[model samples]
Target: MSCLTARTGRQRQRYEGHLRLVSGCIPYKFEKSVGGSNCSTEKDLLVLMISSPSRDDLVFPKGGWEDDETMSEAACREAWEEAGVKGVLGETPLGDWEFRSKSKQNSCSLQGGCRGFMFAMEVTEELDSWPEQANYGRKWLTIEEAYRACRYDWMREALKKFVTALPESRENDTIKELEERPLRPISEVEHQMPSQGCFGSHPSIQQLAA
Candidate 1:
């Protein structure tokens, strides 16, 4: 089935570059992370995570997949839009885990759909400044600390895998280290169902918080 492809110029550029490299795609979306720890005598690795204001529970920076957008493209957009950070997304997927919303009645799920893919990418650059999106609370914590901070076991597991696999630091935003995989077409049912439109129909983080 053909996937929905409607990203802007820059987004399209990023998506195309990664799609050229990675041939196939995976359906059944989940959450992913690429975390590391610099723990020692002084301080531990500080990674940022957020909690939904409505639910008031900790969550990693992640979101649903975009139509035809490669894993890297979706990861970067989720990080940027949710965390307000500027960095190159990693290509090597750390891990993928499944999760369900606390409420199946979530605005998006109620109106659109609920399927998503969880993928991780390396952060190439950290912007000196950025603005936090609406109703989101962010915090920096050690990898271990993040485990306690996150609300779900699956989220903690994803973070742990990322922490173990993450490199020392962000060095290059443009260089992609992972070899490309075959790109698979998104399922037709995914596009027609309300689950996929879940977020689009309800475009407020407030619902997440609520």
Candidate 2:
């Protein structure tokens, strides 16, 4: 016998048989200097990791996607709510991963399973406090460190993809220029897909670079 059943009528369905859909962001930033040099260095890319509220494991900031917001918007909102950071969100998800949630009763899966869409967010500002501040602790870690510290194997793969796609190095002048430039609010930025197709139709890394 199946453990799942669809709910009828206007009451929103909570679970979808054996899986729940979720969205999240992988917040990252390029370290501005290396060994006291005033220029930026791509070798020092860092990703933000947060302490999970239910356990001591380190994980990226992510949460459920609200119906009112797009997937990208939900990822950005989760970053701000959970990590107190803000910045430009990639126009598309870098990739996705599936995991079993610890809190299974609230999820649609009989096993508490969930699938997450993960996007890359270039962090521009870090706030002193956030909504989840009391429940989570945040830290910035280098690529290798983040990979090793990640609580799940799927997250490690995502980190690897991010590292592989990053440029070997960036010009100091370009770094300085970007730093000097003011960043507009993410909401103001418009994302346009090339006539070629959506992100799924293109190379994952290339889409991220775009």
Candidate 3:
């Protein structure tokens, strides 16, 4: 069995007023294009999405932002638990959106409303199995496919921010860059990185450049 396990219950869940604080991420990576070394064009970009056990639709990995961790760490944790993948977590958030929780069983104390923060994850490692593998099946989709598959407008907006921040035309945007960095959980590295809000500095993407 995998040593990693998903967190259960919401004992450490954090909230503000009536809205629960939640964190999630759009996990993305680049595949080899026609040229090989450099990833060129939008088609090379692939974002990971996970299936919800309670719903037929797919969603990015996310959950309650526990009081013990920063929102960025919470976002990375969700991606690790739900999607079974890890990479360089962006220092900044793609954005925050207020939306209703789709599953009451999974919601925090605030009924169905949630104030969610999202970050862009540059996927560095893809595991053979994960903590929530039985609960959430993961799939990678191209940017265009992900847009159509997005069930919520906010998720789509997060994705828009991700692509805008790192368009394919940008120089030195390659899978090699992220892969060069050592792999470590966000918890271990969070101290060295800046703690950012929904709106912060230019996003630091951890990708195949992972």
Candidate 4:
């Protein structure tokens, strides 16, 4: 016989959204000023890598922050560890941004677990090379180029504001070169999907027994 008890009769509801943790690091070098003659070849600004670890898809230099470290420390450490450069982190955090990932699972807490932070900073030196274990590489790009490379709204906005404030940036003109350009939609593969209850840990339903 089918059970029709109070608990069995009602349909179960599940959390609709997944939690995520993310961060951002902005670095700029000194390469004289753009659009100026007799400018030194040395790079003036550092454009953090905008690529994803799983693929060549570009993304700003950032990653998950460990429990023991502060957001500031995470940003600085990621810059060195991912880009192979060192510098003083920005005094205040720029802000926090969000993104969804379908690959998120129990092992990836920040992916579909909780909110995340975006930290800012200024670089003190040019990186000759990244950490030995770092699989990522750094690139130097114009403010316009950097903006074009980013996909997320939050990341693009952050890069634009920071680049515009630079002494070398032009006045009156806000955007560098994003007006006429085309942007491919966020990749389907990157979109966050519903969990299959692999860990039996629903976002809202914490394990009370454990």
**lDDT per residue (tens digit) for residues 47-161 in model 1:** 6665565664556666545556655566665565555444433344555554454554445443232333344433334333333344455555444444455556566555555
Off by over 4 Å in 1: 1-43, 105-132, 167-210
Displacement of residue 161 (Cα, Å) in model 4 is 3.2
TM-score of each: 0.51, 0.67, 0.73, 0.61
Q: After superposition, how far is residue 148 of candidate 4 from its true place, in Å?
A: 1.0
lDDT tens digits, residue span 1-210, model 2: 122121123233234556666777778887765564665443567788887766646778877765566777667767877777887776667777778876664666467677777877777788765666777778786665565566566786666656555455333333344336553342232222111101211123334322
Taking all chains together, the TM-score of candidate 3 against the true structure is 0.73
In model 3, residue pairs whose N, Cα or C atoms come closer than 3 Å (at least 3 residues apart or on different chains), thus clashing, are 122-206, 175-208, 175-209, 177-209, 178-209, 178-210, 179-208, 179-209, 179-210, 207-210
Q: Is candidate 3 or candidate 4 better by lDDT?
A: 3
Ranking by lDDT: 3, 2, 4, 1
Which scores greater on lDDT, model 1 or model 3? 3
How far off is residue 141 in model 3, in Å? 0.5
lDDT (tens digit, per residue) of candidate 4 on 1-210: 122111111132122256435454776655564454765454445455434555644555665655555666666656665655566565455555555552553363544543445444555654454442234545565565566566657677666555544455452153534655676444522321111101111132111110
Cand. 4 TM to true fold: 0.61
Candidate 3 residue lDDT tens string, 1-210: 347778888899998888889999888888865654575444467888877775656678899999999887888778878888877777767778899888664655668788988878778887767777777888787665665567677776676677766755232333234335543332231111111112232345523211
